[model samples]
Target: MTEPTRVLIVGGGYVGMYAALRLQRELRRHEARITLVDADSYMTYQPFLPEAAAGNVEPRHVVVSLRRVLDRCRILNGWVVGVDPVARTVDLRPHGGPGRVLEYDILILAPGSVSRTLPIPGLAECGIGFKNLEEAIHLRNHVLGQLDLADSTTDDATRARALTFVFVGAGFAGVEALAELEDMAHDACAYYPTIEPGQMRWILVEATDRILPEVGPEMGRWTLEQLRGRGVDVRIRTRLLSAVGGRVVLDDGTEYDTDTLVWTAGVRPHPLVRATGLPLDAAGRLKATAELTVEGARDVFTAGDCAAVPDLTRPGETCAPNAQNAVRQARTLADNVVATLRGGELRPYRHAYAGSVAGLGLHQGVAQIYGHKLHGMPAWFMHRTYHLSRVPTLNKKVRILIDWTLALLFRREIVSLGQLSDPRKEFERAARADREGRAEEPVLR
Candidate 1:
C-alpha cells in the first residue's frame, strides 16, 4: 500500500489558481493530493481592477473563490511564512490561528509579487494601493466620496483639495486607474450641483517620458496626447518627491495639496519567496529553467512574477511578468508537474510576446497586438473582449456581461459605499453615547 504524493501550492493569484485547477483535472486520485495556501481565499482578476474601481464591473465579479472552483483540492486560507525545501516542509499560519507546519512531497512556489513602493515621505500614511479587490473597492468609494465631500464643503480650499486627484505612476495600473476614475468622476458631476467636471483636477506624474511603454512608444505617445486632450495633467519625466500631509511635491519643483494620492509604481517579488532560502536571480526572482522547475531544486516548481523562467522565444531573456505569460506559465508548469510525477518527459515553457491592451475610460483604449496598433473604440472593444474571455469561469463571465448590459441600459453607478469599510463606526458611537447618557443620569435613593 503506497502513500499518495502530497503537493503544496503557495498562492491564489493567476498562476496559483490556474495551476491548481489544471493539476486537479490531470492528476488521478491515487497519484497526488493537492493543497493550496494563500493570504486570500479568492483570486482577484487584476486586469479588471480599473473597471471595478470605476463601477463598470462589481468588485465581487473580479474575484473567484478558490474553494468553490478548486473543489477537488484542499484550500487553506492563510499566508505561507517560509519554506524548507530540503525538509519538504512549509511554515503556514492559517487565518485566526497560531500556525502550523505542513509537509509535502512537491512544492509549487507561486507566491506572486507585492507592490513596489518607494520610501517617499508620507506615502505609507496617505497613499492608497490598487493591487487587490479591497483596494479597488475602496478606491471607488473614496473617489466618489471625495465628490460628495467636495460638493458639501463651503470652503474653497477644502473643496479644491478634495477634488485634486494625483496618481504617481504612468504604468498600466496607474494609467488605467486614473483614466477610468476621471471618466467616472466626470459622469458623477451631473449629480453634484456645485461640482463641475472642469473644476476637478486629475494629475498623473510619470517618472518616464513615455506612458504604457509595453504597448510601444507611438501608442504611448498617442495615449499621452489623448489624456492631455481630456484635461488630464500628464507630467512626463517627473517623480514624486514627497506627499506629507496631503501635500504632493514633485521632483521638478512643483507642489500641490491633494487628498487623493494613488501609488501604482510597480511590483517586486513576494518577500516569502526570499525566505524560502532558494536560489534567486539578480532581480530577486527565483531562478527556474525552461521546464518551470526551480534551478538546483527539481522538486520545487516556480512561475508567475516570482520565478525568472527562461523565455524560449527570446533565447536569452525571461518571460515578462504579465497576465498573458502568467496564465500560460501556470498551464505549462502544471503539465510538467504531472509529467514528472508519472515519470514522463517534461516539456519546456515557451511564449511569444503578445503586446498589451489598456482601456482609457469608456469607449476609448489603446492596444498593440502582434505588431498591429489599434486605438479608440476598436481598441477599447478588444480590451474588454480579451479580458472578458480570460477572466476565468463561466459564472464570472456571465456576471460581467450582465453588468455591462445593465450599464448600457442605465446610467453607471455613482453612489459611494465608503461606510462599508468602517461599518462598526456608527454602532460604536451609539454604544458610547448610550453609556455616556446613563452616566449622566441621577441615581434614585
Candidate 2:
C-alpha cells in the first residue's frame, strides 16, 4: 500500500480555512492527509468586528472555530516560523515548546496580514490595533471604562481627557470602529447624569485627503459630510507627529491629551512570507499567478491577503485585500490545488470588483454597489445583508442574525468587563502577601 500525499495549510484565516474545507470535500479520506496550522484555533470574522465592539454582536460569535468546522483536517495551533519550498518542509514554532519541521507533498500559504504601523514615538507603548477579536473586546472595555472614569471624576481636565478619543487612519476599520464605539458610548451616556454626549470628543485623523476610499469619491465625500455633521473632528491631509506621553501631536500643529488611540493605517503582508524563501513581490507578498500557484515554486499554492494574485479583471491591479476576495479566492485556490494533485488543468481566478460597504453606527451606513450609491438605512441593511452571506457556516450566520434580531427589540447592553485584561491580578497580589507572612487588607480607594 502506498502512503497518501499530505496537504499542509498555514494560517487559519478565511483563505486557509475555506481552502481546507473545500479540499476535504473534494478528496476522500484515504486519498490525502490534510492539516492546517495557525496561531489561533479560530478564524475571526473581521467585517463584524465593529458591531462586536458596539455590543450588537457577541465577541464569541464573531469567530469560527477551525477545530469545530474542519473536523477531518488536523488542526495544529502554533506559529509558522519558516518554510523551505525546495525541501518541501515547514518549521513550526509551537507555544512554549521546541520547534519541529514537518514535511508535506503540497503547501498552501495563506498567513493573513498584520496591522501595518508607523514609527511614531510612544505608539508602540500606547497605541492599540483593531485587527483581531482580543483588540475588539479590549477596545470595547477600554472605551466603557473611560466613560466610568469621566463620570466618577470631578476634575475638569481629567474628565475631558477621559472623554477624548482619537483614531488614526480613516479606512474601514478605523472609521467603523470609531463610529460604532462612539455610538455605543453616546447611548450609554444617557445613564450617567454627569456625562453628556456633547462632552465627548471624537477625532479622526487621516494622512490621506479622504476616508473610505473603497467607496467612490462621491460616496466618500458624502461620508465625510455625514461624520462632520455628527460633531466628529475629521482632519484630512494630516500626519501624526508624536503620541508620546498620551499627548497626540499632529503635523498640522494640533496637540491634545487623550487616553485612547486606535491605529488602523493599513496592513501589509505577513512578515512570515519573507522568511519562507518564496518569491515575493515588491510589497513583500507572495508572488503568484492568476491560477493561485506561487511563481517559480513547485507544488505551492497561495491566496488571500498574503499573496499578490494578479487581477485579471482590472489589468495591472491586484485583487484588493478584503473578505469578499479572500473567501472567493480560497474556493478557486482550493479547486486548483486538487486539480494539481490529480493531474487536472488548473483554473485561473478572476472576479469583478463588487463595491464597498461600511457601517457608520447603529442603523447608519454607506454603500456603493455596482455604481449605485446608497446611504443611511438602506445602505446599512445592504452592509448587514452582504456580510451575513459571507461570514461562513450556517450556525454562525444564524447566531449573528439572532443577535441582530434581539438588538432591534432591546437597548444596547452597556456593561464593561475591564478586568478581563488582568484576570489574575488580584490572585497574584494575594499570593504575594501570603509569601510575606501578612494578612493583606483589601485596599480601598
Candidate 3:
C-alpha cells in the first residue's frame, strides 16, 4: 500500500459520528484518512429530544458538534447523493459548492432514517414530526403559542381549536413527547389566568393495540393507564384516517378540530441505502452481518437504523431500530472497522434485549429493565440517569444537568419564541415601510 486508505463515511448521526470517533482514536494517522460527509455538522442525541420539547432541558444541549469532538477526522458538511461500490466512488453534493465523485478505498454507509409517512389527506400540510432538534424546538414553541392563542381569543371555536393537541403513534417518541409536553403545558396554565388545565385536550392515536410495545404487553398497559389518569386520551387500536385542515378524523369515527397534529408513526431507512446498489433486506435497509460488515462487500461497513443487522442474540430477528441499539452497534462497528484495517480478528456484535424505560411528564414514568418493573418517580429518575450517561460529550451532559438543577429551583419557562424562526420578518416589513417614506420605526421585537 503506497498510499493511505481513503475511508469515506456518509452521515453525521450515531453510526457515522461514533465510527469516525473510534477509527480516529484507534487507527494510526497515516494508516487511514477519514472523511465524513453529512448535511449537518453536529449529531443530535435523539433520546433527550422529548425533554427538550417539554422545556425540561435546553434544546442546544441535545446536540454534539462533530468538528468539536471528532477533531482527528476531516469533516465535510454535505450530502451523499449516490454511492457505487464497484466504482469505489460516492457522488457528493456539498452544501456550498458543486457536486463531485469522491473515490474511497473503504466505505461506511450510515445515513440513518427518515420519518415513515403514509399517504393521508392533509397530512403533508398539517402534520409535524418529532424527529430532529429543529422540530422539537418548533413543537415546544408551537404548543406554548397555542396556549397563548387560546387565552387571548374571545371566540369559543378558535379557542377550542387552539387548545386541542393530537399525537399519532404511541411508540417511544410519540408517548414520551406527549407526556413531557403535556406536563409542561399543565404547569404553564398557572400563568394564564383565563385558561384551565382541563381546557387543553391531549390525544394519542396508535394503529396498534398497545403503546410502548418494546417493554412488553403488561408494561404497555401500565403506561396506557398512567396516561389516561393524566387526562391524555390514549386511543389504542386506532388509526388516523385524515388530518385535513386540522380536522383530525380517527378510524373509530371520532373527530377533533386540533391545530396541533404530531406525526411520530415510525421511520424508514435513509434513501441513500437504495442508491448504494448494495444488498438490502425486505425492509429496504442495507444487509449487514453479525460483524457489522455489509454482505457481499468486505470493504463496506454499515450499522444504525439504516442497516438491517442480524441480531445474533435472537435468531431470525434483526436488531430493533432504536437509539439504544444504534449506539451499541456503533461501538462494535468501530471496533470491527479497526480490526479490518489492522488485519485482526473481527468480533461479532451481540447483546441480549434489555427492558425499556419511558418518562411520563415530570415526576412520572414507567420502566421494565432486566425483568424488573418500576413506575412513578423512580422510573422517571432511571430515565434521566440512563440518558444522561449516554448523551454524547461531557459538555452536553453537564449543561443538561444544570438545566435540570435550575428547573428544581424555578418554574419551567413557557414563553414562546415563535419569532425566532423568522427574526427578519419584522425587519423586512420596517425596511419596506422606510422605502415607501412612511418614516415609522420598525418593531424589531
Candidate 4:
C-alpha cells in the first residue's frame, strides 16, 4: 500500500479556511493527509468588523471556529516560524511547547498580511490598527470609555480631548469603521444629556487625494461628500506628522490633542514569507502564477493577501488583497491542488472586478456595482445583502440575519461592555492587601 500524501496549510484566514474545507470535501478519504496550523483558532470575517465595533452585530458571530468547520482536517493551534521548501519541512511553535518540525509533500502558504505601519513618533504607543477582532473590540470599548470620561469630567480641556477622535487612513477599513463608530457615538449621546453629538469631533486624514480608491473617483467623491455632510472633518492630501503624548500633528500643520487615534492605513505581507526563501515580488508578496501556485515551486501553492496572483482579466495587474478575491481564489486554488495531486491539468484563476460596496453607517451605504452607483437606504440594504452571502457557513448567516432582524424590531444595542478590556480588574483589586497592612502571617514566626 502507498503512503498518503501529506499537505500542510498555514494561516486560518478566509483563504486558508475555505481551502481546507473544500479540500477535505473534494479529496477522497486517505487520498491526502491534511493539516492546518494557525495562531488563531477561528477565522475572522473582517468585513463585519466595523459593524461588530458599532454593536450592530455581535462580535462573537464574526468569527468561524476552524476546528468546527474543518472537522475532517487535523487542526494545529500554533504559528509557523519558518518554511524550508528545499527540505519540504515547516517549523511551528506551539502555544507553550518548544518548536517542532513537520514534513509535508505539499505546502499551502496563505499566511495573510499584517498592518503596514510607519515610524511616526508615538505611533507605536498610541495608534491602534484595525486588523483583527481584538483590535476591533478594544477600539469599541475605548471609544465608549471616552464617552464615560467626558460625561464624568467638568474640565473643559479633558472633555474636549476625550470627545475628539482621529482616524488616519481613508481606505475601506478606515472609512467604514469611522462612519459606523461615529453613528454609534451619536446614538450613544442620547444616554448622556450633557454630551451633545455636535460637541464630538471626528476627523479623517488621508495622504491620498481621494478616499476608497478601490471604488472609482466618482463614488469616492460621493463618499467624501456624504461623510462631510455628516459633520466629519475629511482632510485629504494630509499626512500624519507625529502623535507624541496624545498630540496629533498633521503635515498640513493642523495640531490637536486627541485621546483616540486609529491607524488603518494599509497592510504588508506577513514577514513569515521572507523567511520561507520563496520568490517574492517587489511588494514582498509571494510571486504566484495565474493558477495560484508559487512560481518555480511545483509542490508549493499560495493565495490571499500574501500572494501576488496575476490578474488574468486585467492582463497587467495582480488581484487586490480583498476578501472577495481571497474567497474566490480559495475555490480555484483548492480545485487546482486536488487536480495537481491527481495528475490532472490546472485551471487559471480569472475573475472580473465586481466593484465595491461600503457601509457609511447603520441604514446608510454606497455601492458602485458594474459602473452603476447607489447610495442611501437602498445601498445599505445591498451592502448587508452582499456580505450576507459571503460570510461563510449557514449558521453564521442565520445568526447575522437574526441580529439584523432584531435591530429593525428593536433599537440597536448601545451598551458598552468596557469591563471586557480589563476583565480581571475587580479580581485584582480584591486580591490586593488591605490599606492598613498585609495580614499577619498565620501563626508563623
Candidate 4, residue 263: the lDDT equals 97
Error (Å) of candidate 2 at residue 107 is: 0.4
TM-score, cand. 4 vs. native: 0.97
RMSD of each: 3.6, 1.5, 1.9, 3.8
Location of the lowest summed lDDT over 10 successive residues in candidate 1: 436-445
Candidate 2 — number of clashing residue pairs? 0
Model 4 Cα displacement at 159 (Å)? 0.5
What is the C-alpha local distance difference test score of each model? 0.92, 0.92, 0.91, 0.92
Q: How well does candidate 1 match the true structure, expressed as C-alpha RMSD?
A: 3.6
Total colliding residue pairs, candidate 3: 0
Candidate 3 residue-wise lDDT, 181-281, digit = tens: 99999999999999999988999999988899877888889899988998999998899998889999999999999889999999999998998889999
Distance from true position, residue 60, model 4, in Å?
1.1
Better of 3 and 4 by lDDT: 4
**Per-residue lDDT of candidate 2, residues 1-445 (tens digit):** 8788899999999999999999999998887899999999999999999999999998999999999999999999889989998889999988877999989999999999999988899898889999999999999999999998899889999899899999999999999999999999999999889998989999999999989999988989998999899889999999999999899999999998999999999999999999988889898999989999999975999999999999999999898888888999999999998888789999999999889999999889999999999999999999999999888899999999999999999998888888788888778778989999899767311
Cα lDDT tens digits, model 1, 1-445, are 6898999999999999999999999999999999999988899999999999999998899999999999999999888888999999999888886999999999999999989989999999989888998888888899899999899879999899999999988999999999999999999999999988999999999998889998999999999999999999999999999999999999999888998999999899999988988999999999999999999898999999999989998888889999899999999999999998999999999888988999999999999999999999999999999999998899999999999999998999898887788887766766777988854333111
Please report, as a residue range, the 10-residue window in candidate 4 with the lowest summed lDDT. Answer: 436-445
Give the TM-score of each candidate.
0.97, 0.97, 0.96, 0.97
Worst 10 residues of 2 by lDDT: 436-445
